[model samples]
Target: MKWDYLLFYRWLALNMVGFAILWVFHMNGMVEPVFLADSSYIVYVIAGLFLYGMVLCGFRVWKTSRELNWVKRGDKGKLKEFADKSRQSDRESVKEAFEIKLFARISFVKYISSSLVMLGLLGTVIGFIMVLTNIPANAVGDAAQVGKLVGALTNGMGVALYTTLVGAITNLWLNANYNMLRTGVVNLIAAILESADPQ
Candidate 1:
């Protein structure tokens, strides 16, 4: 079967385009407010985690593509080394081990992706707590305190909404990259196993 060895590179290019568009939106002041309004700073944390995930995804893609190329050129690369060192003649066991090795490399990306959403939830809880704790007992009767109370409520709401939005969006973005990298890994494993097969 013919394989597009450039698959991972193409996927990485798509991710870069998506990020470029996001950067354009950010530069035009479209997304800046949502980011800035989150006083809890959870949005910033989410962004950082997303960046880290992207880096890991890129690295995985590069490595997988290189290994696939090596296999395509009849090098067998790590698969050959593993089969030789382990002295395992069962193709199934070797395939399973190779799959595990590939997946293990990017496990941290999965964890970081999950943590993004959880942190957003943490921000939301903090926001609600801020809202509840800032309300003065006399807010209903005291006009002067009412203004301050309303301001506090708005701030809390901003934090809640902004963090949730950032978290969901970043998670989706990172997941897309993860899925692409995963597909590459699957293809790489298939290629390796096929090459290793004895005719």
Candidate 2:
């Protein structure tokens, strides 16, 4: 498959399919929404951040794909243009662009992966705090009252669990994309070097 094709669109479809199905289940009441919005809407905020991270990664991928196309064309003149490090005056700098778009930042994939986990952990801790604050359910007052408390606690735990699951799955999803992106980048670099010095 072409790197340009897979770099942005295919994985976007995968994510849409995967997450849409999960959302359908959630909408149908087969699964919970992670946040009731009454207690803590932070889950939604984290999710939004995650989506933004994906966009950043997507931008980086799109930029890299452009460079990959340049490499595949095997344009010696362009390579010379780009490879010249000590250009006295040039507006478009290849080294600078490469560093920004490909090499250094990881497309924000690593950050998203780590941040997803942290967000999940934070949600879980908040859930635990919810349970802790309502600990009077275990105080052994009335049997019916205790049963209701247990149910409430169970629901709280469900929120924590679902958030954790979502975070993990999101990381896995992005990670798969990251691997493909890295492979494409490495290939592009090798192809550019080869094209630059065709022996």
Candidate 3:
């Protein structure tokens, strides 16, 4: 019956600390410029998705923590309901039911984490397309168009590099959160099963 019920809270604290550090870098003009340079806006989309995933993780963590507390308090919570209903079932069945219930919503975080990387790759393709399209066929003989061509090339490259960077960093960030939530889910399942048996 001995379990670290504060696991989710500790993970949340770690997330907050990471965010604080990111904020510090952002305030010092280290992060905003990259986003501003990305005219394709794919980076923004990636950021939005990452935030959504974080919110999902946060909610799941909170709910899991509450359920753990309920189990600890011997209250008639979700785990109790599951235990009562699965009394006649085998241990494997009980474990399966607990996983299905706990992982139903939180699983979307994993999808979001994957999508972030894909979006970043999409941005890279778009940036390369922009670069190729901006090339003037006659720029070799046209001096006036060379400056514009260079500008366009730089813009496209910026978009490509920034989007890729944003996507990768956000994906890693979200996956970290997802992994923590997943670990919490596993712990919750163990606690529920142990409480059900107490042997």
Candidate 4:
């Protein structure tokens, strides 16, 4: 039986890397690109998705860790009590299992991660349009307008890329940890059940 501690360490390292990137961006004043309509939406959407994912992952980790600790106590009687409690109602059991498998499934992460990238692409397209619309037509103040438009475009692109990176990295780390924790949970439960059964 492979231990989950090592995998958890790897997950922590990856999470730290994601945080470091975000900190750097924040320190550089790139956290929220100066409020352009298109650019702002892109950042807001991606941040929302990643934040939701983080919360979901955190819940999975907390519940599984608590169960794993109990199982590791090697108290067969306690294990049987837990299993009985877990099956209190068919509907509740089904809901719990669904939550576990949902977190464990890598596809969930992929979908959100891809969505972040698409959001970035969409931002890029809008940013391009904004810049093109500002093209100078030999007007006296046209050059200044062009510069502002170009700056907005750059900011939009930057937010798009950074958000995508953060989302992907977070999803990857969470998925890896989910699998490791899930395996540990299943193993511990099985052992407890077997020991609790009367010979």
Candidate 1 vs candidate 2: which has greater lDDT?
Answer: 1
Instruction: Report the lDDT of model 4 for residue 48.
Output: 80
lDDT of each: 0.81, 0.66, 0.84, 0.57
Candidate 4 C-alpha error for residue 126, in Å: 3.9
Q: Could you tell me how far off, in angstroms, the CA of residue 51 lies in candidate 4 after the best superposition? A: 2.1
Measured against the true structure, the TM-scores of the candidates, in listed sequence, are 0.90, 0.75, 0.90, 0.53
lDDT of 1 by residue, 23-82 (tens): 999899979898778888889889888998888788888888888888888876766875
Kindly give the stretch of ten consecutive residues in candidate 2 with the minimal lDDT sum: 85-94
| Each model's Cα RMSD | 2.4, 4.6, 2.4, 6.4
lDDT by residue (1-199, candidate 3, tens digit) is 4554586777778788889989999999989988888989998899988988888888888888778788777786777777777876776777786689788868898999999999999999999999999888987689999998998899899899999988898888888888888887787777777788757
Candidate 3 weakest ten by summed lDDT = 1-10
Worst 10 residues of 1 by lDDT: 1-10
Any idea what lDDT model 2 has?
Answer: 0.66
Best by lDDT: 3
Which residue runs does candidate 3 get wrong by more than 4 Å?
Answer: 1-5, 88-91
Question: Which residue segments of model 2 deviate by more than 4 Å?
Answer: 1-6, 23-28, 75-82, 86-101
lDDT of 3 at 166: 85
Write one digit per residue (lDDT tens) for candidate 4, span 83-176.
5655675645644564455345434544665666666566566656655555455433676566665665566555555545544554565555
